[model samples]
Target: MSDAILSPDQTARALPYSALAQEIATLLQDPTVAVPPRIVQALQGGGSLFVMPAADAQVAITKLISFIPGNAERGLPTIQGDIVVFDVQTGQRVALLDGPTVTARRTAAVSLLAAQQLAPRRDGPMLIVGAGVQGRSHLEAFHQGLGVQEVWVASRSRASADALVAHAHSMGLQARRVDEPNAALADCPLVVSTTPAQQVVLTARPRSDAFVAAVGAFTPRMVEWSAEVCQHLARTGTLVVDTRDADHEAGDLLQAGLDVSTLPSLADVVGQTVAWQNAHRPADGPVFFKSCGWGGWDLAAARCLERTRAQQG
Candidate 1:
């Protein structure tokens, strides 16, 4: 069989947010799914490289990503990489997928899953912080997965924020640029932050019963939320994390000084080990989710994309 190469556009087309989120939920529960710890290697000069590998019964996937902070100044995406999918039984490469696209879609799906499980369903404005790739994907996720019609985008760059709003409008979503970050947080019931800023970008007090998904700031040294958000989680709602390893890499959780073991993992909810569906949360509190990027999601999304391409062919 000939190996297929999937471009970023193809990759994005293959996985609709709602379907992708459903597949991810099933993958998380499948006992056959296996993910090894991601390997991070420092480059000789400046940036870093990450290799994530995962496998199930039928296929395996490996995603290689290079992080170059200086790429932004060069007008290039900071993340550059690809995902390779292999047929486990034949040990042959079956397809190649765009890495950053997989990352953005899967990450947003995971965040949507967490939000659905932890927070109550309501109709209100959804807030997206950061106008990067992840931010754009998450806007689609909330809109597709939860039927969020109203959206607010917050970014340090006015142009970037406006661009995101335009994209949202193209998708038939009611989106607007939020100049006041604080006001956006307070008004939106669903908030997702995809910025990579080291300092706190959101200082506003979120409304009680809001759902907050922090997608960026994966490293222990980087943070996105102020201490106020942390304190709110500690006092009122449950803090859900993608994996326990996030305790080491998620600065949002680490800096908040929360007990890692005490927090519930998203896997438990997906696996139905916890009574997540019927679980009652505080009526006037916030449910927070912090993702540290999982390798298993990469493999599952790659497999899904391959299936999609095959059907299209």
Candidate 2:
């Protein structure tokens, strides 16, 4: 059989946010999925080559992406590559999927799953800090998965913010571009930060019932929220990480001096007893889910694509 090379749009359609989130939730509870630590090769001028690999019972996938920070000025995406998935039993290549789309959608799906399990309010106003690919995908995820109706987009470039707002409007959501994301924090129950994490983008404290996801800053050197704000949330709310790897890569939590070992990871939530959840989770505080990238999510996306193909055939 010829290997399928899926365009970004095709890849995205196969792994819808709702279906992708459900796949991730299952993999989180399934112990057989093996996601090893990703390897990073340093490049000249602050670029990086990332090789992320993962496998489960049926499939194995490796994602190759080049992170060229200078690409922004060159009018190119900083991350570019594709995920190559193969059948584990036959050792044959099955599909090649766009990496950026997989990354954006799966990351948003991680946040979507966390929001479903933790957020006190799902269908309320949401604030997206950094209106880029991530912001756009997340707007679709929350809107489709959790029924978010209103959205506010913020970015350093007014044009970028407006683009995301317009994209949201195109999706039939009530959307607006905002100058200050923090100013709207009090009114939004959902907040997601997807900036480059060069500096802090949001400083204000979120409401007690809010569900805020801090994504896009994966390395120790990158940070999105002020240390004070992170610490405030840590002290006053529940902190859950997307995976165990966040203990090392979650700069937002690490820079705030919070011990990541004590936090509940997404993997811990799916199969736990109600008593375990009640004992570990806070009764009345915000939920701060720090999402660093994970290869396991990519594996889940591959599984979703495989299932989509099977259903179609």
Best by lDDT: 2
Q: What C-alpha lDDT do the candidate models reach, one value each?
A: 0.82, 0.89
The count of residue-pair clashes in candidate 1 stands at 1
Query: What's the C-alpha lDDT at position 145 in model 2?
Result: 96
Q: What pairs collide in candidate 1?
A: 209-285
Which candidate has the top score in TM-score?
A: 2
Give model 2's TM-score versus the native structure: 0.96
TM-score of each: 0.93, 0.96
Lowest-sum lDDT 10-residue window in model 1: 274-283
Q: What is the lDDT of residue 105 in candidate 2?
A: 96
Span of ten consecutive residues with least summed lDDT in model 2: 273-282
